[model samples]
Target: MNPLIRPRRLRTTPAMRRLVAETRIHPAQLILPLFVREGLTAPAPIEAMPGVVQHSLDSLKAATADAAAAGIGGVMLFGIPSTRDAIGSAATDADGILNRATRAVAAEVGDALVVQTDLCLDEFTDHGHCGVLDARGLVDNDATLERYRDMAVAQAEAGSALLGLSGMMDGQVAAVRDALDAAGRTDTAILAYAAKYASAFYGPFREAVDSQLTGDRRTYQQDPANRIEGLREAGLDEAEGADVLMVKPAMSYLDVLADVAATAQVPVWAYQVSGEYAMIEAAARNGWIDRDRAIRESVTGILRAGAGAVLTYWALELAAEGRV
Candidate 1:
């Protein structure tokens, strides 16, 4: 029998480590989430998220073109509209910012990268909850499903390859799916935010989307304390015909992600949310960590945990660096 077992032998060089790496990142595996604001002549920077911006329509086309050239998988678009109402009437408008942005990106990229839209009302609603709040100020699930059915048709007509079902309303995936099919958009797909949590990690994203939420969304979003609940959500979405399933704030919810990934039959994805991106960027700016290595390490962990794809803010930059 051999006496010495030096695992260190494989760890001796960068080439050696690379040769045996179990998990890897690729440019085509990353999806860049982009923000498009209405009526902006120029792009505006988000202070909470360094190096990210709310793109004007022109700037959005440029960003989409850049993402296409870099061989990235896709761009997930979130719109910051100019107005909102209690019922979010603008959400179903054909010429609304989101639909306009979706059409613009589809025309710009032209299948070079997948064009996905956030199919939720939070960005459109004046109160900024995922759904319409009743007279009691509680979110109305059935009412919201009707709204999503309308929004689904709008996004599909605008050329979204996938609608991100992030609203967490009851029966959302089935609702959106039926709506799309009835509208004759049998090709439009869904990416369900199966295990989205009520986490503080979404703070930067609220600012990014111009959210008007005055209170917590704990009623609809999954509790951070519950693990089995994530699987339940996943199972429901899959049964409802979700083409993809995702876990948000992935760095903190790798366990939830892992469970969903293990049980899911479709492609599984994870989102390294805005706060997770901001934290890393902030520390890197302060020289507290090696930025390049940290980005790779963080995503590698998520990938190893069973995510086939990751939505990250660094998609473009990582692709440019040829790190994949």
Candidate 2:
């Protein structure tokens, strides 16, 4: 090695490093995930997640408009129903909170930003599972696909530009795609939660949605130990016509995100879930870290790991701060 060829030369200053940075985060590369709860008169703060809120219908509309104004690429909407049942009948109702919110947001934004909806039953189901349960109380994959089919049509009719298939069911992408095409919704896109893991990091999310899941999601969500399985799932989703592939709990699964990005023909996304956001907030509150820099570093790390886009609770704040 030549002494004259020091690598630290590029790291000598912020401007020098900025000039040679390989990855950059942009507002368009951020997707905000919003929770819309039925029966809420106003926005309700999620205590577990400091800055995030469960928005009422009117608040959801305003939030989507703010997201559009912030120049974020999209917003992923998750619905929290007032009542829940075994089959989640509310999910397929056009008048349900999610569908209604979709229509409202779409009307407000009008293609200025992509309006997407979470295509899952967990929030609507009293059992708090992603799929309909069987006699054995296990998730029925094929049965859930049928529900997803109905949900796809419902979301399409409600003006969801992209459907977030997050239930982790087999053949979901194909089933939903066929349903959308059959309904003459060829313009709608699918965002596959291809590598979502069964993670402890989702604890705050359960609180955010008021989930009552008694058991675990190990049967459907990928195990954190199984990196190869994640890639396999991504491949399957891609083969089934997923327009975008995503890895969940992004901070811990940067490896998964990077691998998926490398192999996926479509755009690869990552979800910075609730626990990730809460941890950062908790630390920043105690002054354990620099809040602003930590936030940027956390998201920038995900981007550098190869996510084309990231779904983060911090999207709005980051956009306002011009960090993304």
Candidate 3:
């Protein structure tokens, strides 16, 4: 007697499974997110996210070289300034940590990979809001756009190939685009963080950046419960000249990612945020999960859900292991 349907035929061997795989992860599809702190003689390790560090400028150059050697598509830089103010003055300072880091990394690997910069005020603001606060203590939206314009030009002038606009402010894409063009940085691209959610998954990132936040960003970041809103935000950014759109906290928001990827005119990407990395590392350390398999599976799942590329802390490690 013969069974009419034997689906196991496709799963019979490793070679068969590999040949039938619908999704694959590649080094060129990974973008590494790196942090560099001002005035550090040595790299400072971030406690919440194991194995991730805030690099000194020198160390940042070394690391960026390694990323380029690994064949990753790009590196996204975040700076931790020694000083911050209500308007995040340091963000637009040409000699600020982030800008200096961008220059160094671009010089080191700009010819080999895309050098990107985080274009947000959260890391540079004394209040830790993504934008300036109004007199009544609310984040002023229109006012923030003005600041973003300055930041766009600064980051572009510093040699960032792509400006990651992760502040989630209204009209940010348009403002930044116009700023870049006016500054004659017509080649600088915008990576709009279109659907960054107000989620607990960003907890570890605060530690990484030494965040000065006293309150949640619920007023600006998209609510975690809204999937359709992600699409709407992405659409607005796309129409406003965004070269790429990003959905943050990738794993929990696969539905939003897939939705955005389905119709976006430009490429769609996902950020496997700090909390997701910490969780996997924590579980692996506890012997509850196979670390390598988990990493591969997690990223594969993101790609399967339609992310054209992924920004992950694991990019280097995965590339080193030849897993991507």
| Highest lDDT against the true fold, candidate | 3
Quote the lDDT for 165 in model 3.
Answer: 95
**lDDT for 261 (candidate 1):** 89
lDDT of 3 at 180: 91
- List residue ranges in candidate 2 displaced over 4 A: 321-324
Ranking by lDDT: 3, 1, 2
Error of 1 at 202 (Å): 0.4
* lDDT winner, 2 or 3: 3
Q: Write the per-residue lDDT of candidate 3 for residues 189-234, one digit (tens) a residue.
A: 9999999999899999999999999989999999998999999999
- Candidate 1 structure quality by residue, lDDT tens digits, 136-198: 999999999999999999999999999999989989999999999998999999999999999
TM-score of each candidate? Answer: 0.98, 0.97, 0.99
**Candidate 2's TM-score:** 0.97
Candidate 3's C-alpha runs over 4 A off are none
Q: Give lDDT per model, in order.
A: 0.94, 0.93, 0.95
After superposition, candidate 1 runs with Cα above 4 Å error: none
TM-score of 1: 0.98
RMSD of 2: 1.3
lDDT of 3 at 278: 99
**Least accurate 10 contiguous residues by lDDT in model 1:** 315-324
Residue-level lDDT tens digits of model 2 in 270-320? 999999999999999999999999989999999999999999988888888
